[model samples]
Target: MKAADFASASPSAIRAMIGRGEWTGPTPGMAKGHVQANLVILPRDWAYDFLVFAQRNPKPCPILDITEPGDSEPSIVAPGADLRIDLPRYRIWRDGELVEEPTEITSHWRDDLVGFLLGCSFSFEGALLEASVPVRHIECGCNVPMYRTDIACRPAGRLSGPMVVSMRPIPASLVTRAVLATGRFPAVHGAPVHIGDPALIGIEDIARPDFGDAVPINEGDVPVFWACGVTPQAALMASRPPFAITHAPGHMFICDPKDSDYAVF
Candidate 1:
C-alpha cells in the first residue's frame, strides 16, 4: 500500500496487514493519529536491566507497554494484538549481533521472553503536520535519518551505549514552533534534542546516517534531532545480550491508543 493509503488505515487494519505479510515497510505515515511503538524483546533474565535502562533514559526509551513474560499480546497498547506477527519487520540478535531481519518472528518466540513497547516519534508527526510543521521524511516518502551520538546513556547492568537520534531538516523559521508542538507529548520522544551542528553530536556527515535514509536539507532548513527509540537497539548491540528482538528500523507497531492519549498539554 502507498503512504497515502496508510494515512487513513485503522491501527487494527494495519496490524492485520502486517500479520498477513501483506505490508512490510516503514510505518511512519500509517494509522495517522494513533500511537506507533518500537518493539524490544529480551529474555526474562535480561529484562530487569533493560527496564532500569528505559526508566533512567526515558526520552530515548519511553516505556509505553510491557508484556508479561511469555506473552506476545500487548494488552495495554492493543489488547488483541499479537506482537510477534503484528509488526511489518523484526530484527533478531544473538550475542549483540543482528543475526536476521524477518517479516515475522513467531518461530523465534520463547516462553522466557518479555516484550517491551516503547514510544515512537511517529506518534507526534501528526501533531507536527497539524501545526503546519513539515515532517521532511513523510514529505519525501522516505525513512527519517537517524544517527548515533556521543551522548552516553546511564548504565543499567549490562545495557549502556551512546544515544541515537532521528533528524528532520526544519525551516529555520519554524524551529521553535516545531519544538513546542512536539514537546506536549512526553510519552513520545518529544522535542528537539539537538538543533544545529550534526558534528557536535558525533554525526560526522548529515548525508550519511548510522541508520535510516538521508533526506535533503533545503537551503533555509536547520537539522532538528530527537532522541530515537532505536537507541535501545544500539545498546543491545553494544552489550550483546545472548539473544534479543526489536522492530526493524522504521517498521513499528501501530497501537490502538490515540496520540492525544499521550499528550500532556
Candidate 2:
C-alpha cells in the first residue's frame, strides 16, 4: 500500500492490521495525525543508563512514555496495549548485533525488561503536511531515507554513537516552510539539523541510505535532515548491552496523542 493512503487510517485500525500480520513495514505515512514512536526495549539493569542518555540527548530521544519492567502496556500513549504484539515487526539484539526479526517477541519478554517510547518524525510530518509542505518520501510512496551522522550524541554510560537522521527532499522555495513547520513540534524532532549537503552530516550516498528506502530528489530540491528517534537504536548497538529489542524500522508504535499535542508552539 502507498504510504500516503495510511495517513487517514485510525491508529487502532492500523495497529489491528499490524497485529493481525496484514501489514509489516515502515510507518512514515501510516495513521497520519496520530503520533508514531520509536521503541527501545532493554533489560531493567541497563534502562537507567539509557534513560539518562535520553534525558541528556532530548533531540534524538524524546521520551514519550516508559513502561515498567516486563509490563508491555504503554498506558500514556496507547492504553491497554501490548508493546510486543502491537508493532508490526521487531528487531532483537544480542550483545549489540541484530540477530532476529520477529513479528512477536512474546517468548523473549522478560519481567526485567523495560519499554521506552520515543518521539518520531511522523508526528512532525503531519505539521509539514498541514502547512502544504510536501514530504517527498510519502509522495513517492517509500520509507524516508535515514543515515548515521558524525554528530555525536552526548554519551551516558555505555550508550553512545553518532546521531541518526531521516531526510526529506524539499524544493528550495519550501525549505524554510518545512523547517519552520517542523520546528513547532519539538517533541517530535523539531527543525532541520542539516539543510543540504548530505556529506556535511556524513551521509555518503543519497541513493544508499543506512536505513529505509531512498526516494527521488528533484533537481531543485534540497535534502533536509532531522534528528531521528532511530538514533537510540544506533546508540544501543554501540553500547552492546547483553540484550535489547526495538521496533523494526518503519514499524512504529501508533499512539493516541495527536500531532498538536506535541507541538512546541
Candidate 3:
C-alpha cells in the first residue's frame, strides 16, 4: 500500500502488515496520530549502561518503554506486539559492527536480551503537518535524511559516540511554527536542535546523508535538524557491544498510544 493508505490505519493494523511481510518501507506517514518508537535490544548486562546513556543524552535518546530481561514485548507502548517481527526492518550488531539487516529477528532472539522502546521523532510529523509545516521527505515519499555529528554525547559506561541528527527542510516561513508544534511532544524529541547552516553541526553535505535517503530541499526551504534516536547505533559502533539490535534508520516500531498522549499540553 502507498503511504496515504496508512494515514488512517490503526497501529496494530500496520504492525500486522509488517509482520506478514506486506509493507517493509520506512514508516514516516503511517498510522497518523499514533506514536512510533525506535527499537533497541541489548543483553541484560548492557541494558543499564544504555539506560544511563539515554538519560544523559535524552535529546537523542529519550526513553519510552523497556521490557524485562528475556522478554520481547514493550508492554508500556506496544503491548501484545512482538518486537522480533513487528518492525519493518532491523539492524543486527556484533561487537559494534552492523552485520545484518533483516525483516524479522526471530532467529537472533535471546533469553537474556532486553528490549527498549525509545521515543522517535516520527511521532511528531503529524503535528508538523497539522501545523501547516511541510515535511519534505514525507512529501517526496522517502526517508528523512540523518547524519552523525561531531557533538559528543555524555558517556555512559563504555557507550560513547557523536550525536546523530535527522534533518527536514522546513520552508523559511514555517520554521518557528514547526518548532512550536514539535516542542509540545518532548517525549519524542521535541524541537529543532539547529536551524539554518549544517556546517555548525559538522554535517558537511546536505545532499548526502549517512543514513536514509536524501530528499529535495526547495529554494525557500531551510534545513532543520533534530536529535535522532539513531544516536544509539552510533554509540553501538563506538562502544562495540558484543550484541545489539536496533531498527534500521527510517524504520520504526509503531506503538499504541496517540501522539497526543505524549503532548505536554
User: Tens digits of per-residue lDDT for model 2 on 116-197?
Assistant: 9999887888788899999888787777888889998999987888999999999999999998999898788899889999
TM-score of 3: 0.90
Best by lDDT: 1
**Reference-based TM-score, model 2:** 0.90
- The C-alpha stretches of model 3 lying farther than 4 A from their native spots are 20-25
Lowest summed lDDT window (length 10), candidate 3? 232-241
- TM-score each candidate: 0.93, 0.90, 0.90
* lDDT (Cα, 0-100) at 159 in candidate 1: 87
Cα RMSD to the true fold for all candidates: 1.8, 2.3, 2.1
Structure candidate 3, residue pairs in collision: none
Q: Give the clash total for candidate 2.
A: 2
Number of the top TM-score candidate:
1
C-alpha local distance difference test of each model:
0.90, 0.88, 0.89
Q: Count the backbone clashes (under 3 Å) in each candidate.
A: 1, 2, 0
* Residue 105 miss distance in model 2 (angstroms): 1.9
Model 3 agreement with the true structure over 88-128: per-residue lDDT tens digits: 99999999888999999999999999999988877788899
Ranking by lDDT: 1, 3, 2
Better of 2 and 3 by lDDT: 3
* Candidate 1 deviant stretches above 4 angstroms: none
**In model 1, how large is the Cα lDDT of residue 20?**
93
